[model samples]
Target chain A: MTNRWTDGPGPRLRDVSEDELLAQIFPLLPRGGPVVVAPGDDTALVRTAYGSVLATTDTMVRGRDWLDEWSSPADVGGKSVAQNVADIASMGGRATALLVTLVADPETPVAWVLDFAAGLGAAAAEIEVPIAGGDLSSAPAGTLMVSITALGDVDGDPVLRSGARGGDVVAVAGTLGRSAAGFVLLQQDRADDDEDLVREHVRPRPPYEQGPVARSAGATAMIDLSDGLVRDAGRVAAASGVRLELSTELLRADLDRLTGVLDDDAALGCVLTGGEEHSLLACFPPEVALPDGWRRIGQVGAGEGVTVDGRPRSGGGWDHFHP
Target chain B: MTNRWTDGPGPRLRDVSEDELLAQIFPLLPRGGPVVVAPGDDTALVRTAYGSVLATTDTMVRGRDWLDEWSSPADVGGKSVAQNVADIASMGGRATALLVTLVADPETPVAWVLDFAAGLGAAAAEIEVPIAGGDLSSAPAGTLMVSITALGDVDGDPVLRSGARGGDVVAVAGTLGRSAAGFVLLQQDRADDDEDLVREHVRPRPPYEQGPVARSAGATAMIDLSDGLVRDAGRVAAASGVRLELSTELLRADLDRLTGVLDDDAALGCVLTGGEEHSLLACFPPEVALPDGWRRIGQVGAGEGVTVDGRPRSGGGWDHFHP
Candidate 1:
């Protein structure tokens, strides 16, 4: 793991006292807004200004979810925050605060935790979500993992996947396949040529603002592209008891974005089956003008499952365990 | 780890697909009430009628936090919930919902998870907190970890540790030192003599209903004894910029409870320096009437740190990394 530290000049976490380590991490934590009580308390008090709150939790583990050789600590931090935020957005809510649990081996570097905090703090600040409260603990040697739970505020009637009707138009609020392409590039050792793809694989930029926009404009059902387009869309289809007929013609632009970098088969598979994009997928009723950045990609019908150009998808998406 | 499993057997987690495992766990999840959306969603929606919500997260690892040989899966789950909820209670809040993240190796047992969920759901139901939603990811072999974040409702002015003032009475809402005595009992192989003490080590019974009781009775500040009495009392003392004067005579009863199980020095040490008791330690203004369950053991004064009969403590309590 130390050999994989591509960046230079920092002391290991083992060299610092726990109190001193926390002292360094504290200033980076978000403060002042909806966070009535901040870190260092038994629990943080937050005001959502709404009757309801949306919450979700996710974890990232070393060697399994990421390799230090391929990802910077900051990238790991950012992705962890992004994925949790995306979960809130998928439910048509805005994230208000986050609680982080950092479990690391004693030998882990102080710089890694600080860098990870930078990414987590930056992502939270970007969405106006405060880093509320969390615990830090030790793990067995060589293991470093993080768990983050995010709380969100639903401003109005909470939108859910069960609401998509037969006549609703399906849409996407962010890019797809780039993360998969970037992952492929990294796997092939060709990452040096494509910084954009590599960054996409490392730090996904989920459409956070678009979640509220879609909610305001009446999104029937929504999900984030965490398990890839086909599989996630299949979930929305199953939940709503409607068939999602996606048009590859509408996604021709998506295919066009990947044409040169990958072969035809690789590009097609990446677009349909790749996960970790963190983009928003949604179904909207007819006559609702989509807020900007959303593109119409298909329609909901009185059937089941997800289909591309009227053909059912043969392969599923990413599996966290198997992958 | 398998040898550590003493109970009747079930299928391994690897035997079922992740979806199948989730399906088995979902029916056991608690739903309805303030939960607008249940498990199996991108995120869960919960209603917090108050203007503010209390949030906290805690994690337990297999090897570091508990050995499988000493703790059943149900014990692990219950402890996880109890500890997290205790944090919220320490803040004078009522636990409302919980989001759990369980990371295990592929070869782990599915029944372990189902049983874990059963314990978690039962604990949450006991407190009226729904299981809500969370993510499951794979870990490297020989790893199993659980992280739970509890959201709490602060019905009124939240009691913070910093609020303790001079002349305040320092008290505890639940029994102290039993958990430490239990640990010693287990270590000495005399656990069979006192099943109650051993049960305290495996799963602490924190007085959940007493947090709000103390608050309503006008507690000035509060903290949970997760890290031991002397250490946690020192925290409250430091935060309030006051000295806590603990009386040995007052705590003699606590020591008496451990008389047979531990030597005099060990029993005294367990009462003062042991961790994971999860009891509420609080301060109340002199004029305020104390709650029924709470027992006064000390007093607050205009000074710093903590003292036992006016003498400073000789040693500190648990340090997560070092311990």
Candidate 2:
């Protein structure tokens, strides 16, 4: 298998080799801001409107979270940041910075760690966030685990899970089921060395800026798609005390994007039940025009449970323990 | 050994089993003016005066950082908070809050997780800093890892590692090397199961408030004792371009505390070289009266390297890869 060291580029640790994937990713970060500290310290520090900061953390482990054959270190790092940053965005906030902690086995190459950092750095930069600081530790098992804490600033009211109204439109920004579809493809091509599918499984492309877009669009309630559509939708449904009815026809274009790559059932399954898309799902007033890159997938009604084309969908998505 | 579920006098995760750990840690948090969002839905929000927040994360893995046989979950949780929180304090700030992400093996007892959270809660409460938020996931290995990110508000000046001047008074707050001694005792009594020594090894009592104390005392340079005095002191010495000379006489009290519990050589080794004490070491102008809970332990000179009583001390402390 091609490791990150031989396949990517970036600054490698002095004692450890550098990963090849990092070379392609590091240039994507944003620079210059009230970001007094970014991408290298213990944590990134940024200027907030009211001088208040928001922070959250998420951890991913190999075997349980991702497989080596399906993902590179950079992909691992990118997804780590994406999930944590989305948490910040879901609160109607802008991500300002991040801090990451990594634990890997001794047998794991140092280059993998460097590549992971670069991937995390690149992803943060893409969203104008920087890696402020991090810590590295050694684990005994052959596992690679990363913990990222994202910090953000609240410029307006934090759109909480409890904010959605009964008569709101349920919408989404960005593609769905791509990562999950990629996971299925990667599993099929694990030994075939399919770079494209593997890359998708490893590194997710989250709609980083869409959170602000949804907020500006006057969206009432929102969450990121780390879990499948139905599960994540269930969260908003349960919290907002409204039934969410999704129109599968609205998602036809998204499904078409994955058609040639996945079978009909797989594509539909991915779109409905896949997770880790990092897409923003929100409820808005009927009067609010759907923002660019956002699709109207459903509507909020006075009921409970999520429906796909007016029927209940089954087997939502992957759960850490259940999976 | 009593597990968390069986021992702790606290609530359990019955209906909230699927909820995130941040959900639990949030409501228990005491609200304050500095707190912006108290960690219900996603991230915890805090106000910073420096227009920037200082953040850091560290992960402690089972077996690598601690042995399950000797340590209780509470001890592991406390150390995780102590070490990460100490990083922010070393930068001359008080830990305002924290976000912890825990990864554990599925077979791991549920009781352990609760105990660990309780330990974290107790430690955060002790410092008056709440357990603002967190993430939890299952791992494949028999490991229990914790990653904590600590946030602090910078008041006046950020006392960076690159700040010390020549000829400064080197001082320390809180006791030194007790945890190291405790570690040694535990190692010797691994089979005996000495609860005191094991507790010390697991839960280090950091002088949490001493960070701000040293900062207010006009410390030119500061760091916490996660690495041994000489090693961590070396970091300040190298960063500040000054030499550090530690007086053994000032450490007599510490030596006395460990004497009966530890063999002479082992005790002295732990004191001078062992790590994770979380004591504050600072350099200031010689004219300043040492603050309360602080003792004059050394002098900053013109040359480089750490000298104990006049001779070079041995290099000792935990190394990430080597450990």
Candidate 3:
């Protein structure tokens, strides 16, 4: 779906007007009730229901992660916030706030920076978290590096990566491989100026609230789909001391979604190895009823490696450096 | 005081390890209460007097802020933690925890990453805070970016940059221009290998607790000396709509501390324009007695801009992007 507010290309960097992106995303966020103050403030205020607060930060450098021509400043900003927020989500906690640090080259216009900020603000608002504070600097090359820290409140207990049991049901919420499909689309769009795939490449719609939902659903193991399903699932498998097996038949729908749009090999590859969809992946007891928006993909067993249709998969997911 | 840890010459990147550096700096950190879990854990956990949490983050990139030859990875890590913690302190809060994100080229040795982590761990420990979580990524160029997010707790009311009153007395905790002086020393050190100044350039000793102390002492406004004194102080002066003036005599001791050790003009310039010392610059009501470890440096009045001895000064501060 096209975003009406951010649809048209406007004036050049210096002349473009400012639109409040935070206002758009703020109302979309899932409230955990622990947030004392949400976005649109100097800093977000969150109450720790238990003993302490958990925080983590990450940065995505433009040239390293995406090309400027393919991703707009807003897309860059949104992904930056989404990825960092996913880190917090992986811990089975709701993100309360975020702080962004940006570094751009001199040629990057003020409008680009503002648009980036708007995207970040919108993302934070969508998550019901605030853009608490940030810092800005100039880089030597035509590079843009965005660093974000996501703060979350640990309610009664934090669901750690080491918590899954042997017999838990591994499941996922939101679509997989779409981002990977979108990424390929982006590359092709860059070459041919194909608008459809270009849009998907620029913005991967992540299931933001699914994390908390899965957590509340008694998930024993949790992760965010950042580095493809197989790779991230492997992390859970390795961390939880259990083998995870995905059913190819169960993933047919996802594969079908990309069938006509992507090449056969590329479509399969995107589902197996795509990154940055920000979907929630979790493992729960076999008896638990799966929540809406969640699809059962795999099951946990008494082994270590992740498997596809009871067999070992060859390719590992996306690696920022290696990719 | 030469650091025995880094004494060896000639391509020591592989030989010198982070464990060795961490062992040296670990004992220097403040030990005891409020620190539930420290640096060795996947994430640090700290208890807050108040149930709520406050967090902020910032990142510094190489070439944009410092040169690698002059400063070690550990120094970069320490500065990252120190600066973010200072922001918490500015809010009249105590840092409970921190999370760091580091991006470096793959060619950057694992030892360097560890040392950087060690420095970050040491800085957090010094403030009785811990490194709760972190992310490591690879950069395309020979650049190092360090981002730190600090979680703080509000004891009562948060001291804001916008709260200074017209009649407040401006004061400072800790030395000013030392980092800047160290920077000059580092430049000379690069040219002539001046070891003395170079050491100061690496690990800056910020007055970590001064923020809370100033707040309790009835500070109306406060900020950290991340930027040079003039520039940061000017923020308060501008925000509070009050002119701030420094007593040159009060800063004489700080000046004398670096005298004979620096070139005349360079020394003055460093003291006036240096950044990243992380000292506390705050304003309090006229009736409040200055806290111990703090010196009265100036007074707030009905005017604009920062002044030295009732006269305006120029070219004596650092701006992150402008510089």
- Winner by DockQ: 2
Docking class of 1: incorrect
Query: In candidate 1, which residue pairs clash?
Result: A13-A109, A13-A110, B13-B110
DockQ of 2: 0.12
lDDT of 1 at A4: 18
Q: How many clashes does each candidate structure show, in the order listed?
A: 3, 14, 6
**Arrange candidates by TM-score, highest first: which order?**
1, 2, 3
Taking the tens digit of each residue's C-alpha lDDT, what string does model 2 give over A1-323? 43232223432222121222223222322233333433221123344332556667778888888766556667787888888888777766777666667786655554455556667767766766654556667776576788877777756556666567877889998788877887887767643444454455577777767877788889898888777889888878877788888988989987997777788999899888888777888899999988987889989988887888889765444545556
lDDT of 2 at B29: 21
| Native-structure RMSD, model 3 | 14.9
Better of 1 and 3 by TM-score: 1
The list of candidate 2 runs beyond 4 A from truth reads A1-50, A190-199, B1-50, B190-198
TM-score of each: 0.85, 0.82, 0.79
Instruction: Compute the interface RMSD for candidate 2.
Output: 18.9
Expressed as tens digits, the lDDT of each residue in A1-323 for candidate 3 is 33221222432112211122223222322333333432221123344433355566777887787776667777887888778777666656666656567766654555555556667666666656655555566666655688877666545555666678888888888787877776776666543434544555566656767767777888887878777888888878877888888887889998988877777788888888787777878899988999988888888988887889989875564444445
When just chain B is superposed on the true chain B, each candidate scores a TM-score of 0.83, 0.81, 0.79
- Of the two candidates 2 and 3, the one with more favorable DockQ, higher being better, is 2
Give a tens-digit lDDT track for model 1, residues A93-207: 7776677788877556555665677777776666666666566777876778999887777676556776799999999999989999999999998998778988999999889
Indicate whether candidate 1 or candidate 2 has the larger lDDT.
1
